[model samples]
Target: MDVIARAGRGMTRGQEFRTVVDGAWSADPAHRMRWEMSLAFVAASEAISLPVQAGLDIGDRTPMTAMLEAHFGCRFDTTSVDLDTEPLNVATRYPVVTAFEVIEHLYNPLHLLLQIRAALDPAPSSRLFLSTPARKPGFLQSPDHFHEMPRRSLEALLSRSGFEVVRCAEFGIRSPLFCLRGVRPLLRCIFEKIRIYELAARR
Candidate 1:
């Protein structure tokens, strides 16, 4: 097996952790847990429990790829596509996990979302793990953010492409002092149970 595949196997065997980074890591547990869950979900679904032919990390860049490699201890068969220069509408070697504050940076969120949707395997079990900033005060912290997306806009984009949003919820820490200030976890739990975010699955 190649390094990427071997690394994937190691991760599936519970030998190493996995992550995808878009920025420097914060000390916040909520932030860390959010990414951890996203990675674990993708890894478990494809690499661990089932056969994942290949995986794509769209917008593959230094920080994100570094995080993925460090945590997973594997070099995924990654594609570093920048939407401004090219399209990502091609078959990948495995399932995809586009995580850690990536979608908002895209110049064309819907276009890229469609590109990912097109690349999925026809099998209903194939999955994509996506994380984007929910509409909130801290969501616009980055100057590079092109869009401040709410649940409705994200759902519409995913629905139009043929993906059924299987899970969608905001996860973040708004204030360090007060635990009650965190609304993302509560909201996400509710959505996950009711299948509110599952609308983007292929339908």
Candidate 2:
């Protein structure tokens, strides 16, 4: 599939992996793991235990996608997709698939998950990786996200879509002192974390 890049609601343009992660973003190496990039990647990576020649990446390419390429020792394929509108019916079923911080942007995350189940390799060892913000109070949530699901809600949706959670974990992006900074930090203490899940399609 050809690359299709588009900006968000008011963004001037979409940013690529080079622009968004490697170039524009940096954190102190010492504590970089506290960043969402490190947090999401670590969680997803640690859960892997399979060989992959090729894979599918469900969202736009990003640093995490690069890491997946490294983890699998091969380049994963990506398509021009608008998860909110299009069904992800790829001709090839992938052994590994990733959707990093993307599902929350959709109005119907379940629709996309169903497509993913269909698109993924059906072997028990095949994996679908996903990451998104955990539930938050309305004031702490991003305006663009139409669905900020609690853990159970997300699990239920995935289950209904023919996937079963194999492994999952959550980690915060805030510094240790963040909770002491202000009300927002205290709030972020709970919401700034990202939860990552590894799933296997049901038989």
Candidate 3:
């Protein structure tokens, strides 16, 4: 019996969520999520007209690192840091950092964000792209989720971390159209899509 694979069944961690029990990566929801996040990052990167020369992916537990690097025309160092037990360390200064749906799983997301800010290049154009779930239609405290952040709380954390939010675009909508099959724009609450934000270091 595939114990390791079995242990990962239905897990919400990055790698586990991207992987299938039979050792295949599903492209349905997981890949789609990654693509959307990459789109956000690409848009953010383009906004500042800064090439993603060297970046860090805070918790990219998937194989999309290469794809993301290629898409951004640069390399992104990937990490699978255990936010609960591991201390945040910035090996090298990065002009760009991405933390998709990672902060909610950490005990002290603000602290982590501050640490990440410290590691970012001091250039005003340097950016951090992040996303996390909102409080609406909040999921129960499961083995995966530590906490959810509403818009106010999310903004507070970024400000406290000395990062200025450039944009915060909500995606999910909770509406009848969302339930309808083959809807062009899925209707769900902004919180549901995990609020994606583009931020820059304070001058």
Candidate 4:
């Protein structure tokens, strides 16, 4: 099956859902993931200049929704897409869409990107905001990420998925002193960064 081939083996709907929920999904910000969310919001604001009528948030019930609500003046909605199973069907197209820290968790991100492209509002100012953990040295990475894409690779995937890159930024989530914790932490301090992209659908 193309879904299996593209997504990876053994990622049946049941399997992927279990894997995702167990490790990646979160309901709300317990306190804050200050670095990640703030950075993504900044990128999103700069990406779409028009007033946001509504948004489709991919991972439902996460901090992304609230941060986006604030960014979009609390006018957003969520599709709560099960990236592997549910399609992004909606009565209205979203002017803004966000999937922060979500691509790495997915068994297949391309499918979701393609869906967002197809479902985006046709207005030229409509945009999608996606962020993923940057590819790091092996010692600095999570064991479970389905993809920690290099910047270029991510750009290429977006291009092929029918999005044109508006901008991309890379930054660390922690201070330099975060490395002082351990040898591995040192590697993480040097290599750990998040890449956020602002994209608009191709003409």
lDDT of 1 by residue, 1-203 (tens): 12221111111121222223323334455555554655554454432333334555554343345555555555544544444335664655344445345566655566666666677655566566676656645532345455657678877777776777655554443334444445764443333211123223466
Candidate ranking under TM-score, highest first, comes to 4, 2, 3, 1
lDDT of 4 at 174: 60
Pick by TM-score: 2 or 4, better one:
4
RMSD of each: 9.9, 5.1, 5.6, 5.8
RMSD of 4: 5.8
Cα lDDT, all candidates? 0.48, 0.66, 0.62, 0.65
TM accuracy, model 4: 0.78
Q: How many angstroms is residue 143 displaced in model 2 relative to the true structure, after the best TM-score fit? A: 1.2
Per-residue lDDT of candidate 2, residues 1-203 (tens digit): 22333221111135431112233333433125533464355445544554576888775555555666776777877655656567665778887887766677666678778888888776777788877788988889876666689888888888889888877878777766768998887888867777887888889
TM-score against truth, every candidate: 0.59, 0.76, 0.72, 0.78
Worst 10 residues of 1 by lDDT: 5-14
Which candidate leads the pack in TM-score?
4
TM-score of 1: 0.59
Residue pairs of candidate 4 with colliding backbone atoms: none
- Candidate 2, residue 26: the lDDT equals 35
- Model 1 clash tally, residue pairs: 17
lDDT of 4 by residue, 44-86 (tens): 5655764467887665444545666776674666544466666
Error of 1 at 60 (Å): 2.2
Give a tens-digit lDDT track for model 3, residues 1-203.
12122111212244332223332433445445645565655565555554567888775444555656766678888654554445556578888777766676666677678778888988877888887766655333324555777788879889988988787776652344445644333323232555788898887
